[model samples]
Every structure is written in structure tokens, then in C-alpha cells.
Target: MAISAQAREILDIAVAASEAKLGINPVALEVTDRMPFTDVFLVVSAESPRQVNAIANEIVDELIKHGHKRAKMEGKDEASWILVDCRDVIVHVMLDEKREFYALERLWADAPEVPIEVTPR
Candidate 1:
């Protein structure tokens, strides 16, 4: 399924922020078909808990700055896996180990991936 325009915008902004923080292997999945609540599921990985928190914070700040409010936030305390639900876009920031274990990409293999243009380092 194709992500809505609103979700595309959110994905763009979220990806930019995730990239800025060196968030690794960012994947944007159009989960509208499988999930009714959110249009897109953005999964990103960080090397450490601190990095995970930082990536999640960056996404939250970037979205809120643009007037996007999060409906709910989870896992900030542990920082192993943080989920930010912004209605249309849901961002997941997880530690490398946790991400590898969960394999969200494999779980949502049917969902169409939104290509992200990586900025040169």
C-alpha cells in the first residue's frame, strides 16, 4: 500500500532527523494496510541506549516543531526501544541488538518501503 501524502511528509522530516543523529538503517514501511492507526512505520536503529534516546528525541522535537503532536510515547525510560506514535507516522528507535532480534523489516516484509535519500557524509 502507498503511504498517504501526510505520512510521506512526516517520513521525510523524521528521516532527516534520524539521519542527523546517525540513526542507522532507517526503514519506512507503509503499514496502512496492516495497521489501521498509523499510515507509516519508521524503524531506525542506534548503537547504544543513549543513541536510541537521542534519535527518538530528535524525531519528537522535529515533528513537534513542525506542529505534529505525538499521540503516545513508549519505552523512553529503558531507551532500549522507543515508540513514538504521531497519528499518521509511528517512529521506532531501537538499540542495534533489539532491532536485530525483532527484525521489523522481516515482520513487515509485505509493506512497501519508502525510499530514503541518504545525504553524503
Candidate 2:
């Protein structure tokens, strides 16, 4: 499915935010065809719980700063895996262990990835 321009833009913002927080193994999947509710899924992994929360916060903050409304964030308190629902773009900030265990990329292996160029930090 072709990702909408708005969704792509949001994905870019989320990727940049995640990368800024030193998120690892970032993957952006175009899931509009599979998931009718959202256009994209961006999965990022962090080393620690604190970093997980920080990346989630940064993504939400950056999206809001770009005139996008604040997202509905889940699992922030636990900090192992946080989901930031930015309407068309859903951001997943997970710890290294949880990311390896869950393997969202593998679960949605059929979904085509939205290629993003990450800036070196």
C-alpha cells in the first residue's frame, strides 16, 4: 500500500526523534493496507528503560512541535515498551530485550518497509 504523504512525513519525524534519542535497529513499516486504522508502524529499540521512555517522549514532543496533536502513549510507566499512537503513525519504543523477544518486524514481515535515512548521531 502506498503510504500517504502525511503519514510519510510523520514517519520521518518519528524516525528522527527516535534516532536523536539513540534508538537502535529502527524499522518503519507501511501497514496501511494491513492495518486500516494506521498508515505506518515505526519500531525502535533502546538499551534501557529510561532510554525507552525518553525516546517515546521525544517522538511525541517532536510530533506535537510539528503541529501534530499529542499522541496516546502506553507503557510509559513500565518503560520496557512504549507505544505512541500518532493517529496515522504508531511509534513503538522498546528495550533491546523486549524488541528481540517480540520481533515486530518478523511478525509483520509481509509489510513493506518505508525506507528512512537515519542521521549519524
RMSD per prediction, one decimal?
Answer: 1.2, 0.9
lDDT (10s digit) by residue, model 1, range 29-79:
888988988998899999998999888888888988988875477999999
Q: Model 2, range 8-102, lDDT digits (tens) per residue?
A: 88999999899888999899998998998999999999999999999999999999999999899999889999999998999999999999999
Candidate 1 weakest lDDT stretch, 10 residues:
64-73
TM-score of 1: 0.93
How well does each candidate superpose onto the true structure, as a TM-score? 0.93, 0.96
Model 2 regions more than 4 Å off: none
Would you list the clashing residue pairs of candidate 2? none
lDDT of 1: 0.88
> Which predicted model would earn the best TM-score?
2
What shift in Å separates residue 18 of candidate 2 from its native position after superposition? 0.8
RMSD of 2: 0.9
